[model samples]
Target: MTPPSAPPPPADGLLAAGRRNLRALAHAVSHPSHPPTPLFADAPKRWQRLLPYVVVVALVATFLPLTITVLTDYGMSGGLAGAIAAVQTVPLLMIAHRPLQAWWIILPADVVGGLFALGGPASQSSWPWTPSVIVAYLFLMLALALRETRQTLIGVWLVTGAAGAVLGRLFPGESDGTNVLLLVLSAVVLVIGGALRERGEAQRRLVEQETISEAERAHRTLLEERTRIARELHDVVAHHMSVITVQADSAPYRVGGLPPEAQAEFASIAASARESLTEMRRLLSVLRSEDATGERAPQPGLDRLQQLVEATVRAGVPAGLSLTAGLAEPGRLPQTIDLSAYRIVQEALANVVRHAPGADTRVSVSSDGTDLTVLVVNGPPAGPASPVEAGGAGGHGLVGMRERVRLTGGTLDTGPLPDGGFRVAARLPLGTKEPVSP
Candidate 1:
């Protein structure tokens, strides 16, 4: 027969890849060399966005007067003036699309454009270009600050200074030396501002990363604690409940020869208490740990099917077992699979004793190469009344059985049989066993 199929891998791989790509893109855009914070943090919401646009507009506005003067005095037409102005406008507008890492492109483009404008028809007066160039330098500084790039900030300063020097030569201004000095000073301010912005961005990124790490650590700790609790409850409560059930079943038989009324009453009380304790323990164990203990011996497997049958017989429930095929051949099966199978049988028998007492029960366990199958069927209760005691309708037994089968990638079905009893059938993959610590 074919080996059992493994469970499908988790579906989050694609989602994880997508998140990684997005993070890389954001880092390239906002941090470049440094780590990045959230996008909204790097691209501040309010006046920060408008500040870049404002600087660009102010620089262009300052240049308009110089262009107008040169055109008027040199007989330069409006078309030529508009064309020069449009060149600067187009590149600044493009900044909205490209990431700040591409700011180097804008620096050279702005400087060259400014020098060309100064040496052309707009050369009558240098006053307008001075403020315009300085304003452009300031805007470049702001962009560099936001981008946290030291080299770009320095480049912006050098380009602005060079443009001012060329303009002084072309226009022969009265205060040429002073104008150059002011432009040099402006560059210094831009560099300092850019440095500060970079520091802030770095700190923001560090804080965000720490927060994320802490939250993840806490979540993992909580999960581990829950798993430990589940394992503890399973060992403590399940063990005691098993012992109590054994004791309760033997109570009436041991007290034989007593008055019928006293015997029946004592049996009823014992049964009632056993059922109550089972329900209480089941509820309490809900919070138990999930971790399997390695020190504890692994649970019994299919080999213990006979022992499970005997336990049911001692509990006053007649159970017959049959195996048509797929025995593990000694050590072929893993411990986890064995334990799960044993538990499935144990639970099925327990249900038969509690819900179908005195009913004839048949258990069939077989393997079909890759899969192990178990079928438990019971006849109707032998007495006139239902075997299910009052207030014993907590459905945790079936739920627990299903949980066991699910962990092994198995299937289970249980319902009332058409013949007036109940039947539970399970199919577990033999190969897709989970890890058992022991």
Candidate 2:
């Protein structure tokens, strides 16, 4: 019986949501498309840091005038007014820290205070609302709307409705006070709060999408730049290569008394130059996740080692290949690694022809199941080491070979032999394919 497959990974929760929201906010704030007062506005560090303090001071000041007005209008006497001011101040302070809890405290206290104050001779003066009534309701409603989540705000709205019902019934007519006002204000708060919440959510999504679009744009720019560089390289490098091919192909007929072997060598040089040019074209046009328009040339691998060795021989380097014992199934190697191994051997041979002409060379590929090694050794040159190519170009052959080996998770070691010959050895590990970086 098949055991049920392990459950798919759980969706992210609150912590992930918080982090994503923070990232979106940061991106939005830094984006030029945003308004001046972005959710997490990017102001001067000092001002940005001080913004909370400024908000706190503003809230305090907003409520202070109302508190004084309440004491003046509702309190029976001077000492009583001061005491009333203290009572009102307490709730404002509490609301600053915990709006919901402050609402619970202030509602019953204000209702009871209003009922008891009715006994005083001056109680009838203020009529329905105390002088401070508008500010008190306004601050509390705004506080609830901003601080509470939408789900919790529903409960706040219900509670406000119930309070309104009770206060309207208890006070009645002229003593109805600000009960009707509170009810209307509660509805307004809910509408505004929900709208703002939805707006914020929309902004977060927009920010995330903008981030993705920006990344795609940057990637497209990179691909365009690569195409431009490839065009330039084709002009500078491929032109010289084409000239070499033409020169090598025509050299035998250009001069009289050339031996059969010398003519064959020219032919080999022409063929090798053409082959290099084909590979360069393949590499220049490669793009990540691209679909080829036609079937591409099969990449050269270890199986082509004999033909490569023969070509090098014809190019004046008597080259031999040593295939290791354990590499029983060459096809099992990763396509990229196989191609890389072949290129490393090919480049090493070409380097010998240019840098150490007429040198005897050996190419070896060995695999012990887990790792493959490709090593090339060429004997001391017949003449001085020519560091530059025949066309006066400082070739990047060694650097290119090292890069190919590295892409296959391999290491390359290359330097002059103790006796004056040059050696290029590459060690490639199996099982991993290195991704090409942009």
Candidate 3:
């Protein structure tokens, strides 16, 4: 068995805390290896570029007279007083580069300047803190507050107060509350500068987050559109495969074929078509989201265009539809082409209603035997755009339309009209296997 150790003394904890604080202060002030922090890094305008130089000029102008006054009042030689004034003022330029280092230089220069100015014939009210030194230190504190950590700033403030106290004790005279005044002014400047820097950082973070969110949303929308296109195309392809399977299975019996090899070949064709349909359905299941119940209704075709246009007209956008007489004949166009054409027109009209409320719109569909042309155009809005529209409600209008047309090897054209309206036109080849006319 080991002997138990005695409890540590209470002073041990206090000593540890003091050592920790001192270490923290040392770490806060000593590391000045970071790149320079520009005061106007993002200034884009001409006046903004010139503003920093203007501030330097103004500070120089103000410090000039104060330096002359300090020289006369302190009764120091010209070169000595001017050198001290230069130490106080010139380090301000370094604040943009190494603020903590600048503070280290300025604080000591301030102490020495105060020591010489004490009890001078010209020194009346102000004691250790001359008007010029107060102003210069305040500026330095403001820069430090913006760039440095709060611990560093607290260290700087504590050191400033300690310096003023030491100078007061060394030369006891009518100190005139200059020490308190300088500390209070520097504290206020530090607080305001810290607040402004925090606000700017928060704004930058917010903008960056918004940009990332926008990119993610666009990517999500693209994936959803592709899934929808695959689902619809699956349905179209499945229908054609089902027809091929039935025709191949029935050909031997219905056509009165005599050869056994021919019947076996027909059977093979039917089996292959059925297998393909089964795989497509499996692939479709993977494409569909879990929440989708699977639409069992027959997909709409070009025949539904009139009803779509009528619905849009009832919704407030005065609209008209035109369909060529031949398009009415059933089986005139394949199911894939028919579905693609209908979806393009449906999305286009929906966009008009949402984006250009109360605008005149026209939708026309015609087939020239080799190609099918669809056109939907809407005029400018008769009323002000709703907040939702102006803010871009994030509809997948153009994305869906372009995808549908592309599946059928079609061409799509969409843009804003010169009359402040919108146009969406698509030309689809009549036969998928045939080359499209230029």
Backbone atom clashes (below 3 Å) for every candidate = 9, 1, 0
> Where does the lowest 10-residue lDDT sum fall in candidate 2?
31-40
Please give, for residues 401-435, the per-residue lDDT of candidate 2 as tens digits: 75566556677899998988888888888865563
**Candidate 1: misplaced stretches above 4 Å?**
1-78, 95-129, 159-175, 238-438
Q: Regarding lDDT, does 2 or 3 come out ahead?
A: 3
Best by lDDT: 3
Per-residue error at 334 for model 3, in Å?
4.5
How far off is residue 201 in model 1, in Å? Answer: 1.9
Cα lDDT tens digits for candidate 3, 179-260: 9999999899999988887788799899999999999998888789989978988887888889999999999879894499
Candidate 1: tens digits of C-alpha lDDT, residues 195-221: 777688789899999999878866665
Q: How do the candidates rank by lDDT, highest first?
A: 3, 2, 1
- Model 2 segments beyond 4 Å from truth? 1-87, 90-122, 125-133, 143-152, 166-177, 189-219, 251-268, 284-438
Report lDDT (Cα) of residue 232, candidate 3: 86
